[model samples]
Target: MTLKRIPYDKPVLFFGNIRDLFLQKVTLHEFMKSYYMRYNNSNHSICGLYVGRLPVYQVMDFNLTKDICNRDFDHFMDRVPLGMQSTDILADLLLLSPGPIWKPTRAMVSPAFSSGKLKAMDVVIQSCGEKMSQHLLKRENPDKEIEMKQLFGIFTLDVLTNCIFGIDSNPWKELNSELIAAFYDCENYSILTHLKMNAAYWFFPENLRRFLKVSVLADDSVYFAANIIRNAREYRLTNNQRRNDFLQLLIDNAAKEEVKKPENRLMDEKHILSQSILFILAGFKTTATLLKFVSYELAVNPEIQNTLRAEIKSVLEKHNNVLNYDTIQEMPYLEMVLLETLRKHPPIPRFDRCCIKDYKVRGIDLVIEKGTMVYFSIIGFHHDPRYFPNPEKFNPLRFQENRNPHGFFVFGSGPRNCIGQKFALIVAKYAMVYILKDFGFFSTNKTQVPVLGKNGNLDILIHPKM
Candidate 1:
């Protein structure tokens, strides 16, 4: 209740905002954007609110957001803890692990996405994109209104499975493959499940929540995923096979860690399994969602689409019509279109960082205490007219002329940013180029002129309604 005393641009309402969010009165992004606008002109750039009893400070100023994420990253190095019990596989995720566990795991995983590693994985990505495009072309009614989310979901899942696990899921051929089934099960939650989770999140203490074993993922799906990884590892070792993929990279790292001292070992079986699952979950839906939006945007804006297609054509011609790492990098207009799409529809609406040390704002009297959750709304920043004029308009030219890195939180900012960003972009761009080169996207009767988005339960990314 003491958090209510903190200076706020609007009347301090302890439970009003959270109550609206829990009751589904307002989507999470809408709440954040409204708060951001309410506080944008205030002397202080931060506003206080309560998520249940937990006090959270929402950062509104772009400069302050930059400082917290980049300049003073050490003071806010870790995300707000999910508070899952130690035994849960989610506990060891690099996204949720504390500084000590996260640091070394990040170091090990970072190399897997390096320029060389990505170049090596380019073939796999291109193959998946080609399969998707071929499938689309083969469809009985090519111009029929196709649900792009499902289509891109298949492509992204195929790409992730191949590039991460070195397994050809062949999602194009078998839509209900075991891998796809498990992933869908993990994400599929019923209305009752959502109600239970909302109740627990708002009312249950961390210890009690963990005691109840309330997990965002289904237990059976987790077991199935774990078994898949274990099987893959055994098969690789038994066959003496080597692959240039994320799982193989982790397997090699784990092998190297065996000789290191216990304190020095960066990865083990649990680390590998958890990180592999995290990468799959993290990359799958977000990239699919990005591609879906990009496709939709191009469908509606044919001029921009044609311009982007011309660029893609020119770049691929220079690279001998091969959609490779270098080819993707040469398409600057593609980059701008992607950036504009991300600006309009950031997969993750809100992200947070926990204050590890009490820190005073440089220009304000407020001091955010250690352990307080600091929230950043990607919707607020991306849609702010001050930073992005006519934010609602789908114009890639904004990125071409005046782009502010600080205002962009699509991949997030600073050290704790999404590590798989490059890989995600590569996959998305390859798919776009491959499909656009052969087919043109045009809006249909079912196409939502201005796409609407809905927040999913426990989803870091927002899902669009086509």
Candidate 2:
């Protein structure tokens, strides 16, 4: 089907010049909502745009979105609009890789994220939570504007480092903790990284990205991680001790695969090292952003905060104040609050799927052609009043009723949904329990209301105002 261009009189997307692009850039999610309100009155609607040099389609209806994500899964497997160039720094990680490569890599990493494994890592999770509570307790002054976002970042780092890499980084104790410093250093210099790290392999001859010396890991980051992984591997080999951390799991699986399939080689040291770094990226930033958002919502909605606090107190008292997987799982209200927050402020606002084969949308019979990028507006669907009544109200009861499966897709849907969703929820829940049990969280003037993201930090991931 052809794109229908609405007249200039319409209040949707009326771009006359490059300057209009600036006006549209205020808040992307809001801009899309306005467009949807203007043109999308039915179950299915389309909007076309130029995202850099590529053509893109924005799909609003949840049915078409689910069709691309589930029913037409194969055709929509690996097409994120930004594109994953084979030579990019994250090409080896499951998040960026596509097709055959993503399949095996995802398989190798999947078991480590299983619920059983997360349960096994309970000690690390509890330890990190206790550490965060102790740290926050010491600084309980009311007037002081504590940066909860930064605090949550530290908590997430501590959890991921210990659980994944079998290391401990106390970012709360030292803001510039080695791992935290390394992460932000890489983040600050991200644009400079690709050129510096993979220029010879990825960049085109005349491209400006060639001049940007951006390494996947900054010098300090590389030294820190490379040393940790190299030493950990050496330690495992020397001591013959097997830990249940993600690093150990990867090594065991890789070794097992090597024995099972003599023809194809298993993951080697570089692969393990790359995946470990990927775990840090996947685990820390997104989880931290989620926790921060939950905190923001909790701060504004005191009644919900009190309700969550009561639930945590009751659950912990039942389990003798021990945060185990089973006890935490039993906390329904807590889960609903977290679920509601996810619905309101999803970590990843949008998902892009490529149409690998022609498929007709149900009811409409409109054929989505191969190579067309299908953009799913996850935030749009979550906030749509069709499923969530009084959408703007911060209410957790919607999730309690099992209102609609397609409506609450914060972690995405189908097979290709984020594998680390369970792990992220575990981290957020554990941290929330700790904070609520000990102290109260309130937003200060520094905490920006109607939170907007900083310019350079706008990937698929979400970051709240600090």
Candidate 3:
């Protein structure tokens, strides 16, 4: 089949003019959406462009996204291999594994985020939230303007440390928490860095990049994290500690253990470390980022924030001033606000997949040759006017029922969707509910409300209601 010529503002290079636009501090996904809208007049979803010598497709259409992600999973079993250049410990993580190993690894790791498991972990998350509450309370001025991102980062790091490592990385007890510092270091990614991070996948491919000795992480932060997980695993196994957390679950069938039965050995200490790193990525910065964005959206939109507060207060009253798993599910408005926040600003701006087989386009006669890389613009789909009314506006009501799963790819969709989705959401809710219950938010004099600015300060003063 023949492909339609993608309208270009400039000739194709590694980025063509998209790089220039992106350097203007706009996200690549936003730039692509703006470019596509301005250039295209057709209803078609798929378009082709060249990134360096590679032929890349930017797919924003939900139908096309569904097909690539779910309907025809066999055709695109592996992700586009971004940030998997090293043969280091991260390669064993589910994120970089191709189809063959991904299935089994996913199955082993999936149970860690089960409903019962997250419920048990919620008590830990709530305790972390309580520590965060005390932290905020201890501020010299309770109503002082603060950078919410850092606060949320501490909160999420606390939760992830407890859930993933079964150890408290509590900044309250340890002033110089390297774990917290390492979590911040892992967040060294931005729109500017995304280009370099993804370039290897665009040209070298993952295997060749590994062959060329390319590494994804810059400093020793990953190694530091792995060491922590290793110690935690050793301590847990030695003491026979039975914490209902991720490390404990993985240790049950650890890869290092010698299992005579083939069905027994699905993971090992390396897998645990890899997934611990993954948890640090997914549960730490990304979750904290979500909280900040949700707060920012609420700060800019007062009515919506008040409405959410009403729901939170009502839910707390129903639970007799307690925040627990069952009560969290009662706050539909809270759920809506978070969902709308995700739709407005998905945690990861975009997702990609590498076509593993020569797959024929369902409607067209052309075949996407094996190894061709494709990117799905989460920003494009979230902002599409057809799917989201007043797409720029923050309307929580839009997600009350959440029937439009395919149309909204926040946690992603299909077999390759985020495994820790439920865990992340539950933890985030625990933090948000705790914060919103005691405090009221308003704009600080210096705060500039950001829609999705990567570097925007977004400081807001939080005051406890009298």
Per-model TM-score, in order, reads 0.92, 0.83, 0.91
Please state the error at residue 447 of candidate 1 in Å: 0.9
Tens digits of per-residue lDDT, candidate 1, 339-390, equal 8998988888889999999988888777888888899989888888878888
TM-score of structure candidate 3:
0.91
Backbone clash total for model 3 is: 5
Model 3 pairs in collision:
1-365, 1-366, 254-267, 255-267, 255-268
Ten contiguous residues with the weakest lDDT in model 3: 1-10
lDDT of each: 0.79, 0.69, 0.74
lDDT of 3 by residue, 1-466 (tens): 2234443344455554455543445656566567556533465667765654456777747787888888999999898765444637876768878898899888877888888887788678888999988887888877678887788888888888888778887876664577677767774666556566556555554456565544455446788888888888888778877788888778876634466555565576677788778877667767888898888887778888888888889878877898789889898888778888888877687778888998877775557888888877677778777788798888888986663554688777779988887887887788778888888777867688553465578788878853
lDDT for each residue of candidate 2 in 373-403, tens digit (9 for 90 to 100): 6666667777888867888788988877683
Which stretches in model 1 have alpha-carbon errors above 4 Å? 4-16, 206-210, 262-266, 401-404, 454-466
lDDT of 2: 0.69
lDDT of 1 at 411: 78
Clashing pairs in 2: 192-213, 192-214, 193-214, 193-215, 194-214, 196-213, 196-214
Better of 1 and 2 by TM-score: 1
Considering every candidate listed, which one attains the maximal lDDT? Answer: 1
The number of the candidate with the highest TM-score is 1
TM-score of candidate 2 against the unseen true structure: 0.83
